[model samples]
Target: EAAVTQSPRNKVAVTGGKVTLSCNQTNNHNNMYWYRQDTGHGLRLIHYSYGAGSTEKGDIPDGYKASRPSQENFSLILELATPSQTSVYFCASGETWGVYAEQFFGPGTRLTVL
Candidate 1:
């Protein structure tokens, strides 16, 4: 089973400050993703990686950057935090990209930018 974990379950940042959210997985899966969930919108993908050393921008990568230094770790970086970026972020991992493949989610990190 894929197990994903995220740090700093809650965060508060000032506008223009930098923020880094970390995620780690123990499933040895090939795919990892970062997504943010807002009140009325579906989970929008920000970035994803096929494996370590590779990162791919997803549907909404505008204000975020992603890093995958190793198969077990991934991080999301916000260069300049803004109130608009405040949202619940989730990290997920899956063995495959097919619709049938279940993606495991970590306890979300709620971020608030003032």
Candidate 2:
């Protein structure tokens, strides 16, 4: 089965502090994504990478950044954490199969900024 893991499952940050969320996948999938879930916004993509050493901005990339150093490791960095950015973050991996791709998601990382 495809598995994805995230570090620091829970976080509490100050308004101006920095926070980093790490994700690792064992699926060997080439496409990885980071998303945040909020009350009304649902799941919004923050960042994504097609493969190792490649990073791309997602639909909502304003306050977040991502890094994909290897096939299994992907990281999300919040240079300046803020209360408005606090949300449940998830990491996912997917691969093309036939005409569509299926994604496997990690548990999630709940972040709270004060």
Candidate 3:
């Protein structure tokens, strides 16, 4: 099974500042993703990476960016943080990029903007 880990667990950020969230996966998966969970919007993918050194913009990539420096690590960056961007974020890893691939999720990170 894939194991994913997220750092800090919680974050508080000021407007217009930069915030970074890190993720680590131990299953040697090729596909990794970053998502945010909001009340009405549900879970939305913000960024994803196919493999090391390759990051791709997801469905909602505005105000955010992603980095995949290696196979076991992925990071999500908020360059110009805003109040509207405050939400719980999650990181996931999958063995394959398909409907049937199993995805493992890390503990959610609650981010608050003020």
Give the worst 10-residue stretch by lDDT in candidate 3: 94-103
Question: In lDDT terms, how accurate is model 2?
Answer: 0.94
Model 3 Cα shift for residue 5 (angstroms)? 0.4
Provide the lDDT at 23 for model 1. Answer: 98
Cα displacement (Å) at residue 46, model 1: 0.4
- Give the residue spans of candidate 2 off by over 4 A: 97-100
- Tens digit of per-residue lDDT, candidate 2, span 1-114: 669999989999999898999999999999999999998888999999999999999999998889999999999999999899889999999986764498999999999999
lDDT of 3 by residue, 1-114 (tens): 558999869999999999999999998889999999999988999999999999999999999999999999999999999999999999999866467498899998999999
Which scores greater on lDDT, model 1 or model 2? 1
Cα lDDT of all candidates, in order?
0.94, 0.94, 0.93
- Model 3 alpha-carbon drift over 4 Å, by segment: 97-100
Better structure of 2 and 3 per TM-score = 2
Tell me the number of clashing residue pairs for each predicted model: 0, 0, 0
Per-candidate TM equals 0.94, 0.95, 0.94
Per-residue lDDT tens digits of candidate 1, residues 1-114? 557899999999999999999999998888899999998998999999999999999999998999999999999999999999999999998877567478889999999999
- Candidate 3 achieves a global lDDT of 0.93
Instruction: Give candidate 1's whole-model lDDT.
Output: 0.94
